[model samples]
Target: MTVTLAQAINRGIHDAMEADDRVLMFGEDVGKLGGVFRVTDTLQETFGTDRVYDTPLAESGIIGTAIGLAMYGFRPVAEMQFDGFAYPAFEQFTSHLAKMRNRSRGRVKLPVTVRIPFGGGIGAVEHHSESPETYWAHTAGLKVVSPGTVADGYAMTRAAIAADDPVIVLEPKRRYWMKDDLELPVTTEPLHKAVVRRPGTDVTVVAYGPMLKTAMEAADAAEEEGWSLEVVDLRSLSPIDTDTLVASLQRTGRMVVVHEAAQSLGPAAEIAARMQQEAFYHLEAPILRATGYDTPYPPAMLEEFWLPDVDRILDRVEEALDY
Candidate 1:
């Protein structure tokens, strides 16, 4: 069936709730309103208010409640509504949700999934569009995963919900309506493994979430220019499938990292450092980054200039090939 990224995620949540009565979903407007994006539509009606309900307009409280429910053996799935809003709950994520397992010396398990709609492309307001995955990826005890396609959206959401450890699912809000035809209950690679979306030999472009689409577009453009570009989707950010990345780099011999987040201290930086450390001899040129500037997310009108696009990605790819 043809399913959109948003609908795929809704089905994933629905299936999880159906399979496990212990699974619960709650967030602002998630119950009756079905979420601002309608990703949670019909869930409340299907499961009723007992398991699927709405919470106050407090990000911290939502996360805190999820943590408590998790401690009590309930696998709570909390939604942060937007990317920037998750900052208010950073304390709960780092100090409590992430540390609980270790603090209890392996006796406590927090099977909590925090869903965040992230990235900039919908011409949203400042706080509405922000890439905060870096913060969650940097946290030690959390698993971070993002899906670029409709199938991965459903598969990754299910994996995140079933994981015993805390997980942060970064949904690419810009691609919510992006659709594809696929069967239900689709399962791909393991949650932490990266996959090569397009194979090429000239250079490897590594990206995830919203940037995956941009990278694939760049690869298509590069083919017309006589450059074979390999696009790798880093599905899981925290654990980072380094082996897959290194193998791609060894074959391609050149690499360019792309992301919507600011270049400084972003996921690109970590990937570049790891590639150099593990496969420096295989690199044909210095790792280049096509990303946003260090400045805060630009206003809606100026976001076009701030966010990375196919042109920027190709520019970096050309530079890498030229070297």
Candidate 2:
């Protein structure tokens, strides 16, 4: 079946709720509105108000409620509505959502999933377009995962809901409309395992979420230039699949990391550090990063320049190959 990324997420949530009565969803405008992107369409009508409902426009309150519900043994999937909007709930996320199990000495497990629509390229106004994955990925006790394809969106969402610890699902807003032909309830790799999207022998291009598509395009273009670019999608960001990444690097002998987030202390930096430590001997060049500038997300018109695109990614690949 052909399904868009948004539809895949909706079906994933619907299936999870149907399978587990404890899996409940609540967030701003998620009920009747079906989310800003309509990703939750038809869920409320199917499950009624109790299982699927709406909440006030309070990110902190939404996350707080999810934590409380999770403690009560309910697998709560909370939505932040947009990327920047999640900032209001940072305190709740870092202090409570990410530390509950440790604080309780492993007795209390918070099976909470916070679904955040993140990244740019839709040309929305301020606060609507942002990539805040690094914030959650940097926090301990929090599992951060993002899906680049329809299959992973479904499988990863189910995985997040079933997890004993809290998980942050960063949906690439730009890729929401991207479609693929695949049956429902499809399970791909594990939540934290990185998959090689395109195999190559020259350089490895690592990306996740919105940037995955861009990296793939770069790989195709690189082929015309006689460079084989292996693309690896980092499905799980927090507990990164270093094994997969190291294996790819060992094969390619060069690497370039890409993301929509700022370059400073971003996921790319962490991956580069790990690759150096684990597979330094196999590296042909210093791992380079093609990412957003170390500045705030620019206005809608300037986003094309701000976000990492195919040209920028290929530039990094060329530089890595030169080394």
Model 1, range 197-272, lDDT digits (tens) per residue?
9999999999999999989998988889999999999999989999999999999999999999999999999999
lDDT of 2 by residue, 1-323 (tens): 99899999998999999999999999999999898899999999999999899998889999999999988889999999999999999999999999989999999999999999999999999989888888999999999999998898899999888888899999999999999976854869888899999999999999999999999999999999999999999999989999999999999999999999999999999999999999989999999999999999999999999999999999999899888
Record all residue pairs in model 1 with backbone atoms less than 3 Å apart, i.e. clashing: none
In angstroms, the error of model 1 at 146 is 0.5
Give candidate 1 regions above 4 Å deviation: none
The clash tally of candidate 1 reads 0
Q: Which regions of candidate 2 deviate over 4 angstroms?
A: none
